[model samples]
Target: MIPAAHAPTPARRLTVEQVLTGRLVQPLFQPIVDLTTGMVVGLEALARGPAGTVLEFPDRLFAAAIDAGCLGALDLLCSERSLECAIAATTPPPLLFTNAEPAVLDQPLSPHLIELVGGGLPFRQVVEFTERALSAVPGSMLRIAGQTQRWGNGLALDDVGVDPMSLAFLPLVEPEVIKLDMSLLRDPDGDHTRSVCAVVRAEADRTGALVVAEGIETPGDLDTARLLGAQWGQGWLFGRPAGIEQRHRYDASAADLLRPARPGFHERSERAYDCAVDAATPSVATRAEVVAALSRLRDVVAAHDTAVVVMSSADTGLPGVALSLAELASSGRPVIVLDQPATTEFVVAAIAPGRGCAVGLRTSNVLELVTVDDLPTVAVMARALLNRHR
Candidate 1:
């Protein structure tokens, strides 16, 4: 029998008192370097909780904050801590990249922003609005965008290609900076994500805005971002997040540390995609009804390729949104997400093709374009296209 994957240890939850006390949330900085000059142009502040705590990690930290109904409070604290840290730095970079959620934006400008306006800030400030939330409320975002701009702070649309709604609001927000989502670089052979990156570059050029590529974890990703017209990048390859005291201590030549891509990475990636298509036995059903069939469908796919599984839209976020993205990244098997017409296109657009992902095409709201009348035919076509590309 195949060994089961180890389950993660449960995180120790953080109480609202700890959050309000400002004793648990610690702000760490990650450098954003200029691709052409290899100089650190800015630092993005990331939040972490005290060591050995459940909230020590960022995803868990924010998740707990959300659960406790203190998301806005946490955001404000992060902003305050980030600026305080930057001010404490002996020679902080000229740009400080911080974040403000939609909830925080709907209210008056963050007090940290007001503090910057009081003449102590020695550099330009950037306030990033992650598009995942902004996409749902365009009107509130527009108002906040205007409010930030009026405060003399640069605006950034974070995770540009990850959410389809970001695309629709791009022209409307006209942000001074657009951050290309790192998911775009995950699949070496995925043409769609690359095409979207190119489109983002073209749009940035047209608007006279700079494009910052987030998550440049590998040398290949760095090179790809440069070729795709990214002027700036942030990720572990440059430096891991650190306190202000150690922020400037990273290796200036960290880009040189990018190991050569393994000889068969591309071939293996393509083969994985081909296997997913060949393994799937498609079914016809509505989004709501698909949940009941997921177990059987997962078994069918696993019988052919044990790594793959089928998931319904409802299954998504039953845990957390980040968990879905993590599944997309880790599962060697293709995760075919079944959803209604409105979400199918967005999910498909967000996924990298070579990472074992394919959206079951929907016609109207009921039937799949590829799996309606036959399943084998769709598999055959998918295999043919994938093999041809290979």
Candidate 2:
């Protein structure tokens, strides 16, 4: 356990509690302007804490929330407050952009939040998330991505070019707004910049999604934003963040609703249990086929260091199955080859958080295989099995 002296101070802890329970944080809106007409298209609501405290700034505010183990609560509180403020504005903007923490994507929200989703905000709400937690919390992220679509809210990937995972999971995220990291525009001549631009352009071309360049403080930065294919932009060049109640609200044409979250996820319909991309009747696999599938599973175990395996008891008799399981176990992954043969006989491997998995079910035949892929379904199935045994 951590020492008391090392813990957050009494005053700091009290500040976090006061901020969350009392909803004392302030919401500041920064306009997202259209580059062509220089018109306000949307407003991104940023949260600030109470005055004269360490929590007044966001960096310290969120860090304090994280230390208190109430980051999720703070996130929900901020979102709720932001939504309420946007709707209460004299003239509601067309789009309201708000931040969402990646780790909170899967947790249940309060009834107030659910009701808010049902009622819909004054404007089409766009929730922004960073790819920083994509690998750390993928199961929740993927489910929320699909859920956000079902909720009729737009999704934005912020600080996209700062990490490789951003580009790697771009397809999975399928965001409507790509908020390029500020650094990309500040120093745009690097090889990495070209790569990011190419990918962003290709994605925009394919999806017809709008690009928003962040931190465009100067005319030069505005030019850089245009060169990067940004149609919408946010920075001091447009306007500083001002509160809704403040008299600094600008008048611009109401922008249309941003694109809805794209389809291709199965969880939106199936919810918690069924996560299959396609539910096809299981088919039998011959000895050669079973061996080949096991070989692939072995490779998956090798590649994904944290992947866990749940093998069918029947598959234990297959050629080299014992050796493969031994190798997987020696690699220190939590592997289980069931001893009892139920109606299903399959070899399943899943990485925690559902980043990747290999799933193949089996039956009375050598294997009652349905499919194999890196879909989140395998992760869901593996988790269900793990729970049942526990």
Worst 10 residues of 1 by lDDT: 346-355
Model 1 per-residue lDDT tens digits across residues 112-194 = 55766545565556778886544343334555554455555566789877754455345444567789888876763477576
**Residue-level lDDT tens digits of model 2 in 96-181:** 88888877766777778778876866677787889764545555665666667777778888997887446645554657888999
Against the true structure, whose lDDT is highest?
A: 2
Give the number of the best model, judged by TM-score. Answer: 2
**What does the lDDT read for residue 86 in candidate 1?**
84
lDDT of each: 0.56, 0.67
| CA RMSD of all predictions | 16.5, 7.8
As a whole number from 0 to 100, the lDDT of residue 1 in candidate 2 is: 89
142, model 1: CA deviation in Å? 2.5
